[model samples]
Target: MTARVGVVTFPGSLDDRDAVRAVRIAGAEPVPLWHADADLKGVDAVVLPGGFSYGDYLRCGAIARFAPVMGELVPAARSGALPVLGICNGFQVLCESHLLPGALTRNRSLHFINREQRLRVESAGTAWTGRYTAGEEITVVLKSGEGRYTADAATLDELERSGRVVVRYTGGAPNGSDRDIAGIANEHGNVVGLMPHPEHAVEALTGPSEDGLGFFTSVLAHLAGTVPAGADRSG
Candidate 1:
């Protein structure tokens, strides 16, 4: 059966359609999920696309974190029964929801920065990154003001020890994130949050590269059971 990935559309979301298109390009059905709807529509996985959700009021994703859809997503994701991918503002929501450690703060430049960023795949064990090999470099578009990832030293250490650091900025940390981190996964590896916009880079015709397609493909592989359990590292 073809996998069905839900692309959520919250108020002020700017990349919902792009995410849906990416899913379709990855050979999966794209289901539209509303932020106000608690139902997931039986999607195999979910993608929270980038945007200025809730008008970026009350701080980036702070308010959107409490959306009705998140109420159901939190528990399901925590149980490892569902896979969730958060991109840019979605990453902010994930941090605010406490599904992932660390918060995305203002850029060191204190301005909205937009660029094509290079990231090294640090962990491929996660549901969203399984298609990538460790050390693989991929380019994705990034646009945000509060994109620096920060966490307590202890938490950062723990994430590193547990192989939860899924991706890191290559060459330099454009947003000044701790340890040059750009993405991370939950303990169960079912939930991932990243500052870059993979959905925007899935198509070669419209993006810097097709490297971002791996993320969507990885989830499909996981749902198909082609990805082995504990098969976390890709050298």
Candidate 2:
């Protein structure tokens, strides 16, 4: 069966369509979900695509947190029944909603950053990253203002020890994210948040590399019972 992945679109979202296209390229069905609607459209997984939701007012993803859909998503994600991936602004939402730990702060330079970023796979155990081995380097585009990831020392230490830090800047820290983190996952490995835009890099003709496609594909494979919810958890 083909997996149905839902891509959410908020008021000011710019990447929802791109996320849908990426899911299609990964051989899964893309389901467009509206933020105002409480219905999830019954997708196997969910993606909160990157964008300035609610105009990024008060803080990114803050307003969008109260959306009705989150009421459903939080439980599904916590149960490990539905896999959730949050990209860029989506990451902001995850942090705001407490689905994922830590917060995305402004860049140390306090400027919007847009560029292709190289990242290393710090943890391959998440449902979103089963295709890559730990320490593998991949390039994906990152564009955002509040991109820095920060956590208290205790939280950071736990993330490191638990192997939940899924991705990190390879060359060096970008935007001053602690431990060069580019992505992270929850304890169940069902929820993941990354600062880069993977959906923008799924097609060969338009995508930066085939690398980004792996994220969508990995989720499909995981649900297919081929992987024990991320068999490549080897770090």
Candidate 3:
């Protein structure tokens, strides 16, 4: 059976459709979940796609954290019953929701950076990154204003110690993120958040490499009980 993947759509979600398409391309059944609903409908995993929700007021992910949908995401993630992946603005929401560590601040230049960028897979044990090898480099689109990630030094130390920093910019910092962190994961590896838009780079005609396909495929690979052999981060 195809793994059921849930993609949540909030009022201002811009990439929900693309996220669903990416899920479908990864060979999963994409379930459309609403931001207002309190149920997951029994999905095996979920993806919070990018977009400016609640107008990024009071912080990007702050308002979405209280959405009824998250009411189901937090504890489910804690118990490992369901896996959650947040992309771009969704990453901000995940952090604000306390599902992941650190906070996203305004980009270092205070300008939105929209371009294809290179990143390295820094961790392999996350719900969304199992298909990648440690230290792998991949190209994906980066577009956001509040993309800088900040955390207390102690938390950064903890993440480094526990191998939780999942993805980092390979060629220096893009947004002045502490440690060039592009993505991070929770302790159980069931939750992941990243600033780049992986869903945007799945097709080769899109200029940026098709390296982003692994993001969605990783979840499916996990469900299939097969670790991808070609997903080496050293590339």
Candidate 2's TM-score:
0.97
TM-score of every prediction relative to native: 0.97, 0.97, 0.94
Task: Please list the C-alpha lDDT of all candidates, in the order they appear.
Answer: 0.91, 0.88, 0.86
Candidate 2 lDDT at 167 equals 91
Q: Write the per-residue lDDT of candidate 2 for residues 112-156, one digit (tens) a residue.
A: 888888888888788888877888888889898899999999999
Q: Whole-model lDDT for model 3 versus the true structure? A: 0.86
lDDT of 1 at 80: 85
What C-alpha lDDT, on a 0 to 100 scale, does residue 34 get in candidate 2? 88
Best by TM-score: 1
- Which residue window of length 10 is worst by lDDT in model 1? 226-235
lDDT of 1 by residue, 142-212 (tens): 89899999999999999999889999999889889999999998888899999999998988799999999
Evaluated at residue 98, the lDDT of candidate 3 is 86
Per-prediction count of colliding residue pairs?
A: 1, 0, 2
> Where does candidate 2 stray beyond 4 Å?
230-232
Tens digit of per-residue lDDT, candidate 3, span 1-235: 9899999999889989989988998889999999999999999889999999888888898999999999988898867657788999899998998888889999999889998889988877766777777878998899999999999999999988888888898777778999999988877777889999889888877538778888899888876767432133222
- Clash pairs for candidate 3: 136-233, 136-234
